[model samples]
Target: MKRIFTGGTILTMAENKQVEAVYVEDNVIKAVGTLAECREAAGSGYQTVDLNGRCMMPGFVDTHTHPMMLGMCRIWADLDYPKVAGIDDLIRVLKEHGKTLPAGEAIRGYAFDQRNFKERRHPTAADLDQVSTDVYVQIMHASGHCNVVNTKLLRAIGVTDETPDPPGGALGRDKDGKPNGQLFDSANDLLSGLDGVQPQNHGPNIHMPDSPDHLMQRFEVGQDFFVRAGITTVNEVQLTKQELNTYLRARDQGKLKMRMEMSFLSNYLDDVIALGFNSTFGDNWLTIGSIKFYSDASLLSGTANVSTGYLDSDRHEGYNYHEPEEMIEILVKAHKNRLHTLTHATGDGAVDPIIDAIEKAQAEDPWPEAIHRVEHAGLVTEEQAIRMGKLGMIPSTQPEFLYLYGDGVVDAIGEEKGREFMPMARFKKYCSLYTISSDAPVTTPNPMEAISTAVTRRTNEGTVLCPEQAITVEDGLKAYTIYAARTLRRSHIAGSIEVGKLADFAILSESPLDLKEDEIQRMRDIKVMETWLDGEKIYEKK
Candidate 1:
């Protein structure tokens, strides 16, 4: 059936910008133009869907996300604070949640940031002991870099004081040299039911394979979260074999409501090459993205490899997951196999190796058309940006950092440096690609809020970190839409509202483009009235 949506300002995102109506037939857009023209083309067989003079645009495409983890957060014990003030409050909440769990079930908690705790430190085994001694309780940090478990868990998992730390991870120790039950990076792999050691060539235990049904359950939860935020498409940043199976099963069961592009981890580069998978391996619904390599740790935990290190009395430079030689080797091999790379390098320290590797890889075998990306690009310098642009590399960045963690960044690395932490202006001037994402579960997946952060560069405290770095509203919108779709190489089918493209759209309460700079911050208040996928109304605000 053909449908005509009228009485609205349609921001097609095409060169023309605005249109009066959009006509859809099945899962593709038929036309976008004046209401009278669209109505005439529709004839009497079409149904009219009134937009009530609201605004409609291309659906948001989140180019980076961890769907499984996001879903797990929904099902697990949420220890995320301001709700739970301190260590005691966290234990109390966990204890209360534990009561609801079935017998013999391991208590799992998520989104626990020690930075927000009054104690201002990681929770140790003793701290968690107050919650439960018998149960093996595990609480993951909000950054997803590490976890703190109880002694019971350590004992149950057979990790002792004598246990050696993994190559890229460390086990926190007490003053007496005993295991403090705090695990960082690869150390958390001990809980993944793997070899209890880091994978041979992998970064950590990111390959937590689960049953297909379990994946479906988790996908259902995460899908709803993204859909509500008006995200019709997502680029799953890191996918293992298990994730591959989960996505396949979900698609087979018709559970995949949004378009997904999966980028397998760099650890599995051998397997990817052996399988002969290329960038265009899958269909539009689920496609191969790029090979993701973890170059360093999280910035929130101060584990990110920064060149100048932390600006404090006791200056300490963070560590990298792999040596420069090792990183170069991985990048070269992946590039040789015709797979694009997406290296996660947040700090200036880690960024060097990644840039070096990419430059070397391109120099050896230049694939200028292949879009190699740098995730986070959090502490990139102007020189690095220039190198990236010259290499035709893209920075897959998250602007929500400004909204949620801007203050923390300022606190760690002085206000002057923090002002340019994620420099949007410099990135534009250097790199041609301007992709932005939520990095959800790290921060919420609200595109409007993400855009607000980009346009304002303001933190939750209302402090504008860098007014000069602030991007325009149009740039923010394009970052989330066209640029994001370009990241996955799906701009032809997705991205903007154009004829002969997928009729994926988001209906907003107001036109963000028509708003003032001050009003752009309030874009979060503009409700997502409806989200459409494949020309079907998947989400409607009540």
Candidate 2:
């Protein structure tokens, strides 16, 4: 069947190209030109879609996400700001949520940042005990790099006061050296018990398992969050065995509606190698993309390895996830095996070793075309950006972090260094390739919000972090579209609207390009009216 769409701004997102109409045949774009050309391309038995002055562009490609986690978080207690103001509010919210759950069922709360709390402290085991002394209670930090569990859960997990912190992770402790329920990075693995997804220190161990059936349902719920946000393609950046099984199950059961590229955790490198799996290892709908590594801990959690040291007195110099030699060896092995690597390096100190390892990997076993990525690159320096650009590394950034955690970031790193957070303008100048993503469940998957934040550099509190580091709205759109597709190595098929490309488009209420200076700040006001994937309507705003 052939379909023609016209009467609106069709942003091809190809060098800022605009056309009058688009002609689609089944799942592929047949022509993108004037209406007459589209009409000619689509002969008889063609349906016309009147855009009615709305805007049509490529559906967003969020290159970094945790769909399963995002979905699971939907069912958990939301501890995002304005909803839960302080530690007291957090405890109350969790308690209220616990009452609604079946008896003895674990209570989990997500997106809580102690930095935003009126008390300015993490809710300790005792604090969460206020929520539940009987049932297991765990509240994850907004960074997803840590979690604070109640005393009951900590005891259940067998983490005692004498338990030594994991090599790449730490446990928050009280003055007398008692466990305080704050689990950072690999310490979160304790919450997984023995059977859950354990990435060891290779990645943050936060993906606790639920029943397969429930997880499948949660996966659907999570994909909907992206679909409704006009995101048609996502790269699941941390794929453990549990996530792998869940994704496969979702695919086999026909529950997957959006395109996914899974990046296996470095912990699974041996397994992947044994199975002879390399990048782009699966079909279009569910493909294996890269090997994910964590060079450092979470920026928001004040654990990100920064040479300058955090402003926080307790954390001071942040920590690295691996020794430099260990990280290099892993990178080299992956590189030799012809796999793309995406290392989470949120701070300058964390980023340096990653770049060094990449350079070493290429020098020893060259794969010049390999698009190894530096995930976050949140506190990347100008020199580091240039170095990454020289090595053809992709800086996968989340501009929405500025919107969601900008003030907190400033508080942690101080204004001077925090101003360089996500530096889109610097990326443009130094790096040939960079992409914007939501890091959903941490923030939102809303591209418009990210774009707005990228352009305005404004925080949720209305303070602009670094106005000079802001990119134009057009560039922001490209970051989510073409550049993101390139990051996923799916550019040929996914990014823009062109002949022979997949007909994945987002119909918006207005063109983001049309927004003026004052209107740009309100860019998120432009809604995603409808989302089409594989030439079929998948989501529509009611």
Candidate 3:
């Protein structure tokens, strides 16, 4: 039972993008209107807290995210690719950052785009080893499907030319069939066995620190980071069995603080089916969300399986990680098991087949409220967008990506198709558009930043990648809040500030939708005066 959140301009995001302060009780928003109305409704028994005329809104729900990757903030090396001018610049960055770590320790970095670099090629192990033969290092390409490691690092991890490649992953090799120290999705097996990668100080596994009492510690810290950015929930994509078990153990212990709709990796379909679980199969804080399958390489890593070629180079054509038939098979299996299926679909070319596959599976056995998702449905055809809406599929997109990668899209997908980047308006006209967070160690989990970007559709100076696609600030706000909740099928309880909805909201310095776009960006690091999850104050900015 709580009292009052008064004197703040609240963005309810319910029906209209209404503004008001609210009163709460029994862990739900009891009333919303002017401050006097809430205070009067609350009475003397209510615990009163004034917001001093700031913004109070439903916490943002990021539909796509990976919180564990936050450890990368402390552990891995980031190549800073988007900022680099050329290959020589990347080499310089590696040489500088490699000097401060343990001698044999590897350098790992993320967020590099081949389109922006002069070399237009990822740096391999030899490139890294040349600077420091003693150190082992790996740089994950922006695509997230692959990364390149140095010889020292790969050898130390025991990846050799003779080692057979792991399923669903690739070990990039060079002249004469020698491993070139580049690994794609298959890198999981290659890195998992290496205790060195998890961090020796934490435990046998060097990458995942062992000192935390439970995984919830990681979740909470990650949640705070998200709240500060105004993100209320996240669709944490791709969980393995062990990872799912960890989340369960943490939740049972009451460690998870934010709302999470976690997805299952397609590889584990058989195991999940044997257990008899399907999509939207759990409670408020945790649940068995969509099942994940890959359609294309990550957009940042420069492979999106498009019919067109990359603007940077002729050889660098886009590609899909999974075969069309195999993808259809996954959808069929998931549909049969009654689990909702969501895949990573990004290219215009991939759109037709991906949708066709979904249609094929559904045509035989329809999922009555399937609530399927297409991750990064960035460059979809007009017909495909319409079909998605008609068929009840959700386009789980990253608005933040449009803000960050708009320029890169032009270089990576060519001008003709590049203009198709996150054309949300057209999609909204034809499909059910949804927004969620894809976060660290991917993109940041900040909803305010996401809100600003979504509305502005900001790109590199002098270049508006798709200005016509820009959404209203109010719509952008909902994309992260209510729209996000709907994507997770959690709208019944969370999403907006209304009776019976959980009292989960963030206190901000000012209303984001009211402030000028430029001011909104400068409002970075704004404090959350308080955060309530289940009618309880779990976090209050110190």
Clash statistics: count for each candidate: 0, 0, 25
Stronger candidate by TM-score (1 vs 3): 1
Off by over 4 Å in 3: 34-41, 81-104, 156-178, 194-221, 515-530, 537-542
Query: For candidate 2, lDDT tens digit of each residue in 376-408?
Result: 889899999999989999999999998888888
**Candidate 3: deviation at residue 499, Å?**
0.3
- Stretches of candidate 1 exceeding 4 Å from the true structure: 195-201, 204-211, 311-315
lDDT ranking from best candidate downward = 2, 1, 3
lDDT at 400, model 1: 86
Could you tell me the lDDT of residue 165 within candidate 1? 76
Arrange candidates by TM-score, highest first: which order? 2, 1, 3
Q: Write the number of the candidate with greater lDDT, choosing between 2 and 3.
A: 2
Which predicted model would earn the best TM-score? 2
User: What lDDT score belongs to each candidate, Candidate 1 first?
Assistant: 0.82, 0.89, 0.68
TM-score each candidate. 0.96, 0.98, 0.87
lDDT of 3 by residue, 1-542 (tens): 65787766777878645645678987778887776877787777887767788777887787777666554443445655455656667667777777777676556666666666777666677777766776666676655666777787788778887976654455677757778887765454466664313211111111333344435555555555665555656676767544566678777877667777778777667878988787747887788856877776556665566777666643366666566777777777788778877787777766766687778878998777777778888887778888888887788777667766787777677787786688777666776656645545556666666656656676644366666776776777777778878878888887888767888887777776666756655433455666667767666766
C-alpha lDDT (0 to 100) for residue 234 of candidate 2:
95
